[model samples]
Target: MKPSLASNRRTDRYQSKTACITGIVAAIEDQASRPNAAERNRSAGPIV
Candidate 1:
């Protein structure tokens, strides 16, 4: 059976959002562990 277009779009949006959130969390964790905030921020880049 074929999937609906709306469902596909929703799934895509959810995946992208999840990825963005995950990246942000990782960046935060890195910042907490590392002393250099500047480097962590740079590594995080657009994710934060």
Candidate 2:
């Protein structure tokens, strides 16, 4: 009736991977929504 450690690990990995992918997708969408700002920053280079 108990789950194995391997199964638990697989579930954890899947969850983390899903979160990471979601974050990346959100970042892409944010960048897409502000392409002009992103492009300007890239062209300006590091402000420091």
Candidate 3:
């Protein structure tokens, strides 16, 4: 069988949207923990 012309582009868009949402949530959490962000970052490993 051959690959379909309709690829995963549509699903990719949805996945990007979800990523945006998570980014927003992380932003909010960062704000909420603004004071400890530096300390947390120091203790935490580098993000992938």
> Best by TM-score, which number?
1
**Ten-residue segment with the worst summed lDDT in candidate 1?**
1-10
Q: Rate the local accuracy (lDDT) of all candidates.
A: 0.77, 0.80, 0.76
Candidate with better lDDT, 2 vs 3: 2
Query: Candidate 3 local accuracy as lDDT?
Result: 0.76
**Highest lDDT model number:** 2
TM-score of each: 0.61, 0.61, 0.53
Per-residue lDDT tens digits for candidate 1, residues 1-48, read: 234566787787777888899999997898788879867567887653
TM-score of candidate 2 on Cα atoms, chains taken together: 0.61
5 Cα displacement, candidate 3 (Å)? 11
Report how far residue 30 has shifted in candidate 3, in Å. Answer: 0.5
Give candidate 1 misplaced runs (Cα > 4 Å): 1-7, 39-48
**How many residue pairs clash per model?**
0, 0, 0
lDDT of 3 by residue, 4-37 (tens): 5675877767777888999989978886879787
lDDT of 2: 0.80
Error of 2 at 34 (Å): 1.1
